[model samples]
Target: MLKIGIIGYGTIGEDVVQAIGKDREGGIQVTSILVRDRSKYVVPSSLADLMTEQEAVFFANDFDIVVESAGHGAVKLYGEKVLAHGADLIVVSVGAFADEALQKRLMQKATERCRKIIIPSAAIGGLDRIAAGSLGPMEEVTLITRKPPKAWYGTLIEQQVSLTELTEPYCAFDGVARDSARLFPESVNVSAALSLAGIGFDRTKVKVFVDPHITSNTHEIEARGKFGQIMLQIQNTPSARNPKTGYIVAMSVMKTLRDRASHFVIGV
Candidate 1:
């Protein structure tokens, strides 16, 4: 069985554990989890074998793969370390890679160690098409994200306008993926992932919308290139425990791990 280590024990982390536990295929199992505060969460005693130290989580854990559902800071802190230790690291926080310097350094470290960094299609779809479209000459790529106004409260958009009082759909910001990730770090991973897969960050455009009428987070991608134009949209419900993260993101991570551990993998 492939042993998996999770870097975050929040909503996404817990969800991954639950999904793996219920998976009848029995190909992969979550061997351990890393969290800053363990006492706050109730972990089952039956799965105590899966629990381990927090400080030495990365270096000490014995696992084949490390899944990072943690925030960008966690990715920046432990991403290279995980890959350097000869383990594949699956990063869910794709927005962190928007920093070209950091991305280059991580790739360099991974190359030196002969390990790989995997980016999952979290909270979005049609990545296969987007990646395929890259084979031809690409002209433009745009990602538009729409979410409830409440989701924008703590973000920088809060300063510009009241999220509660928005009567109409408002375009909070419009710029490149690099700027979007830098500006709204918590909400733009899909854009960053699309940018990396289709075009470079500078060339990929991003637009964030705050709609009072919308309940779920919506993502739309439109691309035009020599392969022609492709348009895709995803409407995602927030995770029940963590409203900030879409539930589909966790599902995508689980799907990636399952595919990696399975004998017959489908859809690269």
Candidate 2:
């Protein structure tokens, strides 16, 4: 059985466990769940006993892989430690990689330990094509994200446009993927994924929209290269627990985990 450890027990974390039960054809087990306040949330009967230390790096040696679904802050805090324990890491908070040095350092540690730092195609798809196209010359890659106004709360978007007073869609940001990821860390993770898959952060363009006119979060990705022109668009339903992100992000992570252990794998 493939033993797994999860770093968060929030909405996405809960859904991941359900997903494992839904389909674990290849024998995947949740051995541990480390949360900030374990007392606040009740653990499922099957996984109650595996609740373990959130801070001890050596504790991760018990699991084959550690999944980080907490947030960017958790990545900065414990990511390296998890990798140092010689356990592979799955990062749901890809936005945290916007810090070039941190990403490199973590990758370096994973390499030294012979472990992998994996990032799921969270909240988007078609990254396979982009990654493949990297072997050839790529011309352009762009991501346009539209979300509800409340999702923009506390973001730098508030300084430029009034999200509350907006009646229609407002382009709150237009920049490269790096700046977009840093500026809108909560919602623009798709930008970081795009940059990582295809071109470097500076080359990938991004546009963030504060759209009160819409309920669902939408993203449009366009890429052109030797592989040919491809445009992928998806509208994601917001998570009930947090409006700042989409529920599909959690499902995407679950799918990645399943594929890791499944006999049949899809995509590149």
Clash-forming residue pairs, model 2? none
Off by over 4 Å in 2: 24-26, 45-48, 57-61
lDDT of 2 by residue, 23-85 (tens): 737578887788877678776667676665556632645878889988888899879988887
Per-model lDDT: 0.85, 0.84
Top lDDT prediction, candidate number: 1
Report the C-alpha lDDT of model 1 over 154-239, residue by residue, as the tens digit. Answer: 78898999877889999988999998988887788888889888988999999999988988999999999998899888899976
